[model samples]
Target: MFNRRQLLGAGAALVSTAAWSKTANAGLPEAAIMETAATQPPLHPQSGPDYNPVVTLNGWTLPFRMNNGVKEFHLVAEPVEREVAEGMTAYLWGYNGQSPGPTIEAVEGDRIRIFVTNKLPEHTSVHWHGLILPSGMDGVSGLSHPGIPTGKTFVYEFDLVKSGTFMYHPHADEMVQMAMGMMGMFIVHPKDPNFRRVDRDFLIMLNAFDIDPGMYVPKVMTMLDFSLWGWNSRVFPGIDPLPIGKGERARIRVGNLTMTNHPIHMHGYDFAVTCTDGGWVKPEAQWPEVSIDIPVGAMRAFEFDAIYEGDWAIHCHKSHHTMNAMGHDVPTFVGADKRNLTKKIRNLQPEYMPMGTAGMADMGVMEMELPDNTIPMMTGWGPHGPLEMGGMFSVVKVREGLTPGDYSDPGWYQNPPGTQAYEWTGELPEPRKAADAQTQITPRPGSHNTAG
Candidate 1:
């Protein structure tokens, strides 16, 4: 409740003139800001209906206060410095104190009041994506209401008609706003606490940034060829692992705000798609899947029982989408002869080295210096060795005895004796060649081999 605008007292500009705007200015609620990129503990409801809270991957949920019969919340749209990883950070437009703003969670059929303050230089508006509400509170800049001008506050009041995964983003100058990372998840838990319940619920937001290797800001005009793909604005190693206790039923909700689709793949479990932005799929309609492809601007929720225990890899299946910075323009050097090129280049720069002739796997382990504030294209290390992974990647740490509420890392997994893959040194055999002659048996005049 302590904001410079609120300090103005009676002089503070009231929200734009609408029927609902005439309601008593409750004085702007405090806009809570998170400073760290680490995932915070779930915000357990102190007084409302009982439902397991959602763990936002690398984010947090906004808190609300009970005002009369309605739940009141505040959101501030401003510029922020967000850590993309430990070493890299981005200057982005966001809500509260982070890019991809804090999630707003409430129960179905609950009447809520939201106060959105615009701190950016330009005017903005918030669209309650995929939520059923009055047309006037849709947050569209022109059609439904006027933009919230800079340094001004606006109010949106509506009832949560249904419960499902939803989103919030700017409707004014959408291209520029969204590209700057002005978005967040909106969750409406079912009023019935046991409805489609799970032991652990999680939220992930998929996004991408097109910053050059050392820059701090994204190129807003980039339509494709993004350099850094992210989950909740954080890349691999930076992304928090999903920890599940053995036999625990877990649900993960993913929202895609990026320009392209992401086929998210999990290593060990085949889960059922249980919900989407439209609503929860009936139990009979749910289907099993190992890789769920989330389309642009859509949401997906999947659940599985954590019967197996270990460190399971979870990431996007698109090869390039899982890579980090400075690769799209890098030419293919695999199977190429770089010896002559290396010799010639050494004449000018004596320390120049040849790489990637065999494969880019070397990039993962090579300590070749990178420019300030960037990550390798293919990076990460695991229990075995160099993981050769980057963007949109994280592990799902499933173990037998993890404490129900603890989200701490349990280190690496220790495979039992005889369970790990070992070197096969007992046999020597001739490498087989394909039946080349038989393969060409149907060849016509255009292609031929002498053998018959």
Candidate 2:
């Protein structure tokens, strides 16, 4: 198994260095860089909570909890908010009013019945992504049947055909409804008698969002502005802190329902990709890959043998998303000084800043300059400006060694830094430029830089 984060870090370093040297030697004007920056809009702002719906299986009602603090999944076909960038208070759709929906855990052969109530003011339906069900039960609104109208209820009955990680979300108006926060994770366990040896299992749902109701009204989506992102809803670091033991072999099932592909990066361990949407791969197909590119509408399962002990940052590989507030503008840099007048100043108080922009508002919502040897440990991924959007993200802490203990309170595990406090230390790392000297350079056939 290859640790996904380490491999990607190395690849990014190499590519960045190559790009830098090529541009530097070409003597491109500085204006080119500025022009590129100006053409690029800031990252989107993400908000809302995970979806935690109550399910009735075999006449038993079980409440599925969101891994973090996600509250609901708002499913609407029409535009509820009048604008895109403003007035978009963190109102979202959820499983029982939570984002990331609920985590459904079931054993093989169990028949599960889920009742989905549509509270939004429009029509919608739930598509169980990656599940091998009959097409009529696929829940694609028009394709499956007329969608569940507002104030009506629909029954979703299905058997656990296979055992693995799966997901659910509205298939109609997918781009907008999903963007508005309507999705969740569903899991099925193995039925084999020999498959009961696992210690701990977890589910991670990746998502993204856009806008800051506190700073500005949410903006309407033009073709160019829909790029705001999140993971499970909030950008990483801002969503919730994930804690794990130092030396535990954890089985993590990851699902991606966002619009783009995510190279989910986990630190300190190389794990085996044991299963995919089509189910477990053959023994030969199971190999080591650090960063697996999970395209939209796909899922994967892997077991990582945690070897190192430290607080590690896990997120997407897209550099812009990893650094700031879903790529939105940092309030401090936008107009902090001018907006600091009495009444507005109260709004500018440190506590008033939105999720990702606390404390470091004065540094400007752009790239941060840091020492060469310093490696930033980030909690969330997004831009430093408004429309704070990115997709499902989180962190993983691998302890040095494991001890026998209960599932919830495994001893020797330390909570991540900044769990109790929120602070904006500085600007996020800039996308590596194409002209930096630290980049790796390959020698030409007759160049003098070649070394034996």
> To one decimal, what is the Cα RMSD in angstroms of model 2 from the true structure?
20.3
lDDT of each: 0.86, 0.49
Error of 2 at 168 (Å): 0.5
lDDT of 1 by residue, 1-452 (tens): 32322322311222212223345544566567788788877877767798899999998888776666677778999998989987889989999889999999999989999999899999999999999999999999989999999988888999999999999999999999999999999999999999998989999999998999779999999998899999999998789889889989999999999999999999988999999989999999999999999999999999999999899999999999788885566777765677778877899989786887778888788887778889888788898889898899999999999999778788888988988888998877997767767664343666533210
Return the TM-score for candidate 1, rounded to 2 decimals. Answer: 0.91
Error of 1 at 194 (Å): 0.6
Work out how many backbone clashes candidate 1 has: 1
Judged by lDDT, which candidate is best?
A: 1
Position 431, candidate 2: lDDT? 69
Clash count list over all predictions: 1, 96
Cα RMSD (Å) per model?
6.4, 20.3
Report the CA-based lDDT of candidate 1 relative to the real structure: 0.86
